[model samples]
Target: MSTVGLWVIGAGGHAKVVLEACRAAALPVAGVFDDDPAAAGRDLLGFSVAGAVPPPVRWRAERKRGILAVGSNRAREALATRLAGVDWATVVHPSAVVAPDVVLGPGVFVAPRVVINPGAVIGAHVILNTGAIVEHDCRIGDFTHVAPGSVLTGNVTLGRRVLFGAGAVAIPGVSVADDTVCGAGAVLTADVSSAGIVVGVPARAPR
Candidate 1:
């Protein structure tokens, strides 16, 4: 296979993790682009910072391939939209358990320790953080963020840009609508329709 030059669009911890995932998958990273120009030329886990996103055409023209390294669901959605015309690469860590029948869309980031069970469909630009469990037959929408240690029980369906907080738990068969936010450690037991912040056991909408 021909080596592809991959460009990363962020320079935070998530970017570092994504870089490693790209390396594990044998994709050569051209460099990272961050908002802070001062960050340019700085080393991140052995990868140099290139510049910022909506990067200079010269950079994009050179690399040709890119990945959105953002972790925020909203930001990811926006950035994905901004770079819609660019070729973005999906990076899945070698340690992640993604079932053969699972479908992953472009620019999705499946971090180490992620478990994507059989029949699951993860949409474009989704972020499956470390140790996140996406149980069988679940459908995760575009630009969604399943934070570290969160668990989505079987058949759960999450809409676009849905944010599941760190360690949150979504019980089986629940469906969360687009733009919803589940707070950290919350336990979702029912379907969530309105786009709002939800927290606590049996997850309730925040006041």
Candidate 2:
């Protein structure tokens, strides 16, 4: 925790946001990596691409904390699996308001202006995106993306890999299933027991 140098994985758009977060947190980045061969040797937001990602142990031994900045849930999970040996860092933007006791798992990204209330448990690699709000006592599952401007009311339970889309709203006490996609501007009013795409006000699968 003392050493602020990070080995950042991925060089895409998500990587850009995370790099900014690192800067805001005053965490110096040691290097940047990408799975795409074409991304190597290129520059990402003034940080030179340090070539393709090496095995976690290679970098971890250098005492730098790691972050998986890929956007896709599956890709992030796979990279995390590969980088299992890494000592992960939880990136919380300085502007985000998190309760003193909020439980944030390793590799979680709390973006700018995000509000996580008391008793919330954010799972590993979850993204609480810009301006999103998680009301008290919510439990967000691993790799879930609560997109910008979304709101999860108190006690909402999200399953793994759920995409709570931008500008969406989840009402209290609803349990969303794994791999569920709540479309932008949708309102989730009930439990989604089955994994699928839901949209429109009071979200449901399109008939």
Candidate 3:
């Protein structure tokens, strides 16, 4: 694999973690881009924040690859679409245990200590955050976030732009629909259908 540097798309806490994973994988970080004016020109992990995200033409011309480090699924997806044609890399931390047969799409970031079991298919720009456990045959759709310490049991199917919050657990074979947000530490015992917020034990939609 060639050693090409990347420009991380966020400069906040999530981006910090993603940068660590990138370093762990020995992928150089060229710089960072955040919309916040305060973050512009700041230094993160020895890499300078290079103002806002440049136009695709500018970054692509400079041979800058990118990975979305924003935590919001919708924002990540939107920026990814906007930056179409720019090169993106799939970054996995060395500490993570990814099964040989697990399929990962471009710009997917696997944080430290994540365990992805066999036959799992992680879609584009997904985040398998620190210590998350994805069990056998799981399918996570594009722009979804499996947050820190979350556990997905066997055959779980998560739809696009879903947010599985930190420490949450989905029981085996549960299917969560698109745009659903599972709250932190919530235990999902059944399938989630609607495209809104679900919280607490049993993980029902908010009334």
Ten contiguous residues with the weakest lDDT in model 2: 55-64
By lDDT, rank the candidates, best first: 3, 2, 1
Model 3, span 64-154: residue lDDT tens: 7889999989999889989998788899999999999999999999999999999999999999999999999999999999999999999
Put down candidate 1 lDDT per residue, 1-207, tens digits, no spaces. Answer: 343688888888888899888888888887688887888888998978866665446545664678889887788777776666777788889899999999999989999999999989999999999999999999999999999999999999999999999999999999999999999999999999889899999899876
Query: How far is 174's C-alpha from truth in model 2 (Å)?
Result: 0.8
In terms of lDDT, the best-performing candidate is 3
Query: What's the CA error at residue 156 for candidate 3, in Å?
Result: 0.2
lDDT of 2 by residue, 1-207 (tens): 255578899899989999999999988889999878899888888998888888866765577788889888889888888788788899989999999999999999989999999999999999888999999999999988999999999999999999999999999999999999999999999999999999999899989
Clashing pairs in 3: none
> By TM-score, who's the top model here?
2
Q: Give per-model CA RMSD.
A: 2.0, 1.4, 1.6
**How high is the lDDT of residue 9 in model 2?**
90
Worst 10 residues of 1 by lDDT: 54-63
Per-residue lDDT of 50 in model 2: 81
lDDT, residue 75, model 1: 83
Error of 3 at 23 (Å): 1.5
Evaluation by TM-score, superior candidate among 2 and 3: 2
Per-model TM values vs. the true structure? 0.92, 0.96, 0.95
